[model samples]
Structure formats: C-alpha cells, structure tokens
Target chain A: MKYSKQEYLDYVDKKSPDSPIWKNVLIAFLVGGAICTIGQGFSEFYKNVVGLSEENVKTAVPITMVFLGALFTGLDLYNKLAKHAGAGTLVPITGFANAIVSPAMEFKREGWVLGLAAKMFTIAGPVLVYGINSSIIVGLIYYLIQKL
Target chain B: MNKKLGKQTIRFANGINILSYASIAGQKEGEGPLAKYYDKVLEDAEWGEDTWEKTESKMQKSAVSRAVEKAEIDIKDIEYLFAGDLLNQCISSTFGLRDFGVPFLGVYGACSTMAETLGLASSMIDGGFANTAVAVTSSHFCTAERQYRFPLEYGGQRPPTAQWTVTGSGSMVLTRQGNGPYITHFTAGKIIDAGVADANNMGAAMAPAAADTLATHFRDTEKIPQDYDLILTGDLGKVGKSIAIDLLAEEGFDMSENYNDCGCMVFDIDKQDMHAGGSGCGCGAITLCGYIMDMFRAEKIKNLLFVGTGALLSPTSTMQGESIPCVAHAIAISAKGE
Candidate 1:
C-alpha cells in the first residue's frame, strides 16, 4: 500500500536539511555561477542577434533561465541534481529555467509545434504573465517618475 | 430496512474498542525486534546522526503513550494487540509492545496494515469473538534504510517523486459494543496490475492500485465521489493524484475538489519541507488515527471514506521483474451516526 523507496526518499528530503559539504557547496557555486554567466551571455546574444535592446535582454535573462531550466529538467539532468542537492538546483536563479524546460520537455513528446511549443511555457506561464504585467506597471512608473 | 415506521429505533452500531496496541520501541540498540533476523542486511543499513532505533523507538512509543493517554486506559488493561511493521518480524511494533503484555496478533499487509488490523479487529467484534484489540504498525528509518537502500552513511541520492518513509507508529483501541469510533463498512480492492515496474517511481507504480480501488469502491458501494466529504487514498502523491483525476474523469467522476491523498496531506509542505510526499503504513495510519480522528470527533467531517493503497509488490517480487500488484482497502469512518 505504501511505496517504501519513494516514501523514504521523501523522508530524506524532508528530515535531513542541507548537508554542509565542500564538494556540493562548491558544485552549487560553480553550476549556479555558470548558469548566471550563460544567462548574461544569452541576454547579450539576443540583443546582438535578434536586435533586441539591453532592457529586453535584461528581461530575457529570466525568460532564458526559465527555458533552460525546462530544457535541462526535461533531460533529467536538473532532476538529478534536484534530488541530490535538494535545494541546490531548486534554489538557483536557473530553477526557473529547469521549471520551464522540464514541463516543456514533458509535453514535447506530444509534438513540436503543437505540444512542445505550446507547453514550453506551461510551468512558467504564471511567471511570464506576472513578469509582463509588472513590467508594464514598473515601466510606466519609472517613466513618470523620471519625467517628473 | 426502511422500517423506520414505528419509532426511530436508531442507536449507533455496537462497536469494538481496541484494547491495546504495540510498536517497535526503537532506541540506541541499533536493533529492532527483527534486527537479529536482518543480520545479513543489518551491516549495510545506515542512518544519519539520528539512528534508526532513535527515530523508530521515539515514534513508536510516542504513539503508544498518546494512545494510552487519550483512551484513558491503563497499559495492563489492554487484552489484545494486532500489530505489524516493514521489518520481517514487525519488530518496532511487536517488540516495542512486549512490555505492554497484551495478547498479540501479528499481521503483514504492507501499507494496508491500518485497514488490515482494523479489519481483523472489526471482524472479531462483528463475529462476536474478541471485544478489545489494538492495531499497530510502524517503520523506522535506520531499520528500513538497511533493508531497502544503502546505509545512510553511504550517502546516495534518491529519485524524484520519492516520498520519505514515515518512521512513526500509531495505535488505536477497539472495544466491543463500544461508545467511541466504529468501522462501518469495508471494501477491498482486487489485486490490480497496471504493469508499472519501476520501484524508484512509486507514485506511478501505485497509481493504478489507487485508481482501481477508487473505481471498485465506487462500483461496490454505489457511492459517488461526492458522497463522502473527503475521498482519501493511502499514499499516492502529487503525480498519482493527477493521474487519479484523469482516471476518475473517465468514469464521470471528479475528485478534484474534496480529494486529498494521505501522502500529500500528512505533512505541511513548507514546514516538513518534503518534496514529493510520504510513504509507509504510518503515513496513512497517523493521518487517520491522529488528524482525521480529531476532525471526525469534532464533527467537522460527517462521513468519510479512507482508501489505503499498498503496492503489494515487494523487493523480491519486483526484483523478479514483476509488475507492482497494488491493493487498496477502503473503509468508511463516519461520525457517531450518519
């Protein structure tokens, strides 16, 4: 009636907090740092390649992380780390990337255009919506404040 | 049956009081009742700073103490005990209760033990056999770790969608023609195989059992999902819960609203910080014996159906490449009267 391994895994995740280990701590720093670096690179690339502005790239960093996260998540690489580090992959700025990539990957099998593309944003759709909404408000406020 | 014509001669059903219960009283011994039996694997079992004996004994006895306190019954008064655990001999439950000195009935129904014990005790009362009996089951981390996974000291990663094994225990007292809680009906699920063999992903592995039991429960009882205020399953986590919604929808039932899984419900996500969910007999048992009973006693929920799902496929069975055969036993725990 109960899944032992599954349940035990849950217990491990819950009861044991983050273990202080040099290997994992360093791994978190490196991987997290690498992801951030990639985000900066992507933002610059998008601005240069797609003719988007710096501001657009700034916004795109989060969007990029969300996409990359989903991609890695789908590949199960992020899930592996998420399982081991518990909060490592989950706590990163790239967690949004894993989130988006995972769901998109999950649905990608339904087909690229219809399934993958449509659901690519499923997990992060709320974040996207909130991002867009808040951006509009923030931009308006910033412009008004600066002009005044 | 509709002979309510003369007088509303309606009195609650004569129920049984569970006299005593037992569990693995874990400690620093690093061994449970079944420890000797697990000699081969004991060397491999590991725990964190918290030893298996510690968590298990602490959990098992805590429940024993709580049950004694709540029931207001002295330990010696308990007439019988029906108990089990994940261990070979159900040590944490059996050995822990050794001092309680109640007549014991050992049962191994995997995660369906709560129902198994309750079912056994209920039948004893219904058949006019025994009046007082206790049903208990417990699982400790150290003991379970050695048996199932690498030693905690080994430090290995777990899979996604994995739920923590509950190391706690719960005991209930069932007395004959009693004034307290009574088990109304029992509906057991058939041994169902959906051909899921992955042991790591138990949520998917146990999904069919949960769905099938839910289906069978609805089929056998002629009760809709809406009939009960809460339709609870033993240990299907978020993944299985999603699948259940889709499965139930095929039968024109939607459990999206009043539906909660014991695995998902037992712990506070933020508080316990559990990722996917919880597992083991205690997951559902404690939830029922602890949380649900309190709500039921307070008249918060009038009628409830608890369907505890268990993956009958063991390590040996699964290692034999057998698809998980899951079974769920459904029991109706209602208020004093409907």
Candidate 2:
C-alpha cells in the first residue's frame, strides 16, 4: 500500500487498459474521413442546389451538422455510433453539439431548471466562456492598434 | 463491561446473532455471477423513480423491509435502524426509512458504511441498548457518478484503475439471539491518508487504510490470516488487493491464501470489463449479506474477517485538489459454536 513513486507509476502503467493502436488508428481515420466527406457533401448541396454563395455555404454546413448531431443524440443514436466510430464521432462540430445534448438529457429527470438547463453546458461551458472572452479581448487589441 | 482490545478490537462476550439479511441489485449487478444471492434485481435502473437518487432510496427501503420479513419478526418489534449511502446528507437513508417508524441512525464511511453500521449495531445489541437492530446501505451507479465524479452523460474515458460503483442495496438484522452468523469481534479503523489525490484511483487511496486496519485487527486479537476461513475487504478491486497483499507481507503476514476483495468477487472483471472491478458502499454490504451469507448457511465457511474500505472524499473536496482520506473497519463473524 505504501509503494515508492516509481512503483506507483509502474502500477499505473501495468493497470492501464491496453489499446490496440493500429486498430484504433484505422477506425479513427475511416470514421473521421467519412464525417468530413459528409460535411463536404452538405457544402456542395448548399452551393449548387440551393444556389447559396460560398460565404453562406460555409455558415450553413456547420449549422446543419450541429442540428443533425443533436437530433442523433435525442434519438439515442450518437452514443451507439460512437462506440464503433470512437474519435470519429468526437472530432467533428457535431461532436460539440453532442457534448451539450448528452448531459442535458441525462439530467432531465432532476427537472428542467436545476437539471437539464444547468447541466447542458457541463462539457461545452469552459470552451464557450474562454472562446467568447478571448475574441472580445482580441477585438479590443485590434481596434487599439488601428487607432495607434 | 468493556471488550475493547489494544487500540481497535472489541470482543462481544454474548455474541450478536445475525437474524436475517436481504440484497437488491440493479440490472448490471444482476448480470454478474452473484445474481442468485440477491433477493431482488431490478430490470430497470430507475426502479420506477423519476431520478437515480429516488431509486437508491427505494432500494434501501426494499432491502430493509425484506430483511425484517425474512427474520420473521414483527415490523413494530424492530427497535433501531442503522443505514447510510454515498450521498450528501445521507439522504438515501433519511428518505428511505422515513416511514419505517424505527429510530434511525445515519452513518457514513463511504464504501465502508456496511461494516461501520454492522459494528455499531452489534455493539448496540451486545451493550443491551436494543434487542433488534438493522444495518442497511445502498449505492447506485448513476447517482454516485454524478455526485462523486461526473455526469453520467459526460462519456468520459475511465482508466483501468477506475472502479464501477455497484448499484445495489444490502441489509442485515442483528439480534441478541438468532440462528445465524455470530458477530464475535469488531475492530474500528483509523482514518489513513497516503496523500493520494486522484479520485479515479480509489483502490490505491484506500489500500493503506485497509492494510493498517487489517494489521491492527490481527495484532489486537493476536491472530493471523490463517485463523479465519476467509479475509475479505469491502471494495479494493484488483489493484488494491495486490497492494494490500504486499503491505501485509511487509508486516510478516502473508494473506495470499485466504484474502479476497469484494470488488473483484462481485463482478467478472474480464467479462464485464469493469476494469479494476466494483467499488461502492453497497459493494461490500451486498456481497457479505448475500454471497457470504449463502456460503455460511451452506457450512462452507466457519469464520471470516470482513474489512470494509472507504475513500472518504466529497466532490467539492476533490475538486479543490484535496487528498483522499480513507478508512477500513473490520468485523469478525463466526459459525463455530452454532
């Protein structure tokens, strides 16, 4: 119970779950590539079929992916797919949508206010707070430089 | 009047009889090898409750009432109830037995709650404070996850050192007289902290406490591991069990032959992929009240030592990067004179 630091580190290393490196890499590659292809398809559809400009197409694609991710999560389909897809389900913007929806759904039983609404930001909360705050700081710096 | 031995052991002159017991497990626990030991296994995790906390309360209530029923005693005759859970305010026990009409004593030893409750209940009976008492504890996977670590929906990766909290409740009745395993000795544990801060690795955090308690119990009683048919720890899982073995060996005691962990025994580690195996307040409680009781009834074991280990850390404390403080309480039960 009272092992040295090196022994403790060894114990952790030995107990660590074995991950099949090549197999995981293959799955990640195939899955991640497939998600990107779908995004490209959406962009093409918006540009050609809907006649959207490149700027609008860029905006529409991420919105569509996030919607689909939330819908899949609601249907309880994303987690199942994530099992096989691994990092594939997690690498895309849809994964970000899933990060919000999953915890929200899990806490729904605690009631809408304290449970779902409060927990909706469990995973994405930090990202949003830092991302927005840093952008505001950067905008200030840019304006100050222009004035100088 | 005093049975205290050395620093920890308490020998009950008029051994307390374990009247009866009951265990209730969730779907995942039911699927494990010890399914048959449980009195009831819920097919759904919610157990018809709106939240996991409510479900845990429901389980404790069921386990206690069924244990009393099995003892064939009138509900009004039960004098005291000792129960707890891995929840804030020990809400599971408070809300679960709100209608039992029995005087309640809420205790907390984290995963070691069962042993602590049993030790206290046995002392109460042996001290003539109560003729009949019940010890019950419950833990649910979902409830403990959100409370101790993270939201169930986080889908965070668990390391191999991590243990799955058993979603179950186990209850036992202790009476002054009965035909069951007799509580012969109880050894209280000292709070031991080895400065381990990682919450995920509970086995490591609790192992030193377990080793210290076991060594103290042995020294106080002037006995060794071989004296008992079995020596079981509450929920050390695979990793902590090995560490305990090494630590005991350092003290010139070898426990390889009879030592086992409730965590590893509750679930098939390889098959269930439970990593380091099960850990929770209910993990040891159910295994002892359910599996070990069945073994005792079958006369396969004459005596045993049960040490319930617990990592006493709250989410707030862990979030603030405080080290996990741990404890292990030991109880000696015998069937030799029965």
Query: Model 2 chain B, poorest ten-residue lDDT window?
Result: B150-159
True contacts kept of each: 0.04, 0.23
Task: Estimate how well candidate 2 is docked, as a DockQ score.
Answer: 0.39
Error of 1 at A65 (Å): 34
User: What TM-score does structure 2 among the candidates reach?
Assistant: 0.93
Candidate 1: list runs displaced more than 4 Å: A1-148, B1-58, B270-273
Reference-based TM-score of each model: 0.61, 0.93
lDDT for each candidate structure: 0.63, 0.88
Candidate 1 chain B least-lDDT 10 residues? B3-12
